[model samples]
Target: MKWSEICIHTTNEAIEPISNILHENGASGVVIEDPVDLTIDRENVFGEIYELNENDYPEEGVYIKAYLPFNSFLGETVEEIKQSINNLITFDIDLGPNQVTLSEVNEEDWATAWKKYYKPVKVSEKITITPTWEDYTQKSSNEIVIELDPGMAFGTGTHPTTVLTLQALEKYIKGNETVIDVGCGSGVLSIASALLGAKDIYAYDLDEVAVKSTELNIKVNKVQDAVKVKQNNLMSNVSIKADIVVSNILAEIIVRFIDDAWTNLVEGGYFITSGIIQTKKQMVIEKLENQGFEIIEINELEDWVSIIALKK
Candidate 1:
């Protein structure tokens, strides 16, 4: 099977509205590239941290890039996907040729192409995510290395949500605490919690891919003895209240599930809510406040923010 990708380059300013439009129009997968992005590779540390000039902004508006896989059911050729996307986007600029680029790849090509990017990703000053295929010999023995081979799942310590949660875990985690990683993608949060000294960690995800990915990650990281992974929605069958709850779900989901977040946290426990874009900040905050959580910090990066709160 061949996989095709569509690029809709838009501004950080206009991306969300266009994204909502595409999603409403039945687009499934979307990855964003901000105006600040000077280059391609998403994992590069240079362009991400480089100081920007004001001239980077589009004079008219932003770009919206959407990736549609190459499949017949997606209404045939890349041209068709582009037509549908254009209808939804209501934009004028053509992204050069290949309004939607279609690439043919066999299973082996897909496996290798994605697997190439899965090298060692250091989450914090201490923890490192090393795929089972990679070597961690450069680090000292005292360093905490999470061996993860995440395939078709969300978390891999690359996204800001996972990184912020790891930072929060390092600070808020105390000895012998029960941790619940709601929406645990690739088990990054759960493994980090266990490494940070949590007595028990329960990782749950609504997606089966996430559940399986996290389970594999736990086994690879040698935390299978301590961390448990299950395919379930957040707090569905949680019996013992947790000392720390970490959720990196979408802003609306966090708002909708704030009560469940509160229910999982013990008295004076910490809850970290990430995957929040800048626009939905107030809605999530108000919901958390109403649910008896006192906001501790709003950590921001690249127009994204993570809310860390404590149960009142």
Candidate 2:
């Protein structure tokens, strides 16, 4: 029982796609260490404090780490991951140094190493995401707690992109509205929607692993009846009219489905988009506007932007 820890030195803009490549290559779990966390100011509105170790982070670029089982094909797997990350450059993604290194660890160490990086995080005014292995007490009567495992999935529902989307969902969803979640990694948004009183939800992902992960998380949250999980490309052939269409993915992918999102949303319905780097934020905004969506709000966290628009 041994594991190979693959660490990639890359920029913050490359974290999402690189982590995705690792998961698709059968990595068990992914961990991100960004130097910005060492000095970034966090608002205490949610009473969440971070205790980060400077030694664990890179001085300039971010570190994207994933665990792969030690096996005969480990070398090939690592090569494929490297090539996939390099291909990201074609999409205009910055790769920084792109230096990759590996280390060996026992199964016991690998299992517990990533856990230290995750904790209960208050993402929005009413929503707090906590790992299943952690015990969290609600701070108020109105607080909502989401227990997530994020096993072999994308994130623990505490990433800035996810937090922004959850906050937008909390603000827009009144109650009992149908929600369509595109690129629903870890099912966090769909689960949050159900907790926010969404009546019916459709969660779709191009990756089968993501679809399965979403299904498992939905059941864990006891929202199985509210969310229907499926494996599909971004909004392809989706004809259901929804009150809210939410997606947290690359800005490029988000722009590709702007038309589909506009068509699937009912009049005055909302569209929430995240996972957008600051440079591409304006591009997504223009695409949404061209699709006849009225830009409602724009919010940013740690250089990640989320936009909320209404189909008017």
Best by TM-score: 2
Writing each residue's lDDT as its tens digit, candidate 2 over 1-312 gives 988899999999998899889989997678889887888887643224467889999999999998898999999999999999999999999999999999998977756667766778888889999888888999999998998988845787877888889999999989999999999989999999999999999999999999999998889899999999999999999999999999999999999999999999999899999999999999999999988999989999988999999999
Residue pairs in collision within model 1: 4-70, 8-64, 8-65, 9-63, 9-64, 10-62, 10-63, 10-64, 11-62, 11-63
Using lDDT as the measure, which candidate wins? 2
lDDT of 1 by residue, 1-312 (tens): 655455555445445555665575456756654554554445454112343344643444344545455566655544454565466445653332223343344566756555555667676777777777777664876577777777754545767766776777888886789988888887888888888789999888898888888887888777888898888877776776988888888887877767887877789998888888889899889988988899999897666788999887
lDDT for each candidate structure: 0.71, 0.91
Clashes of each: 10, 0
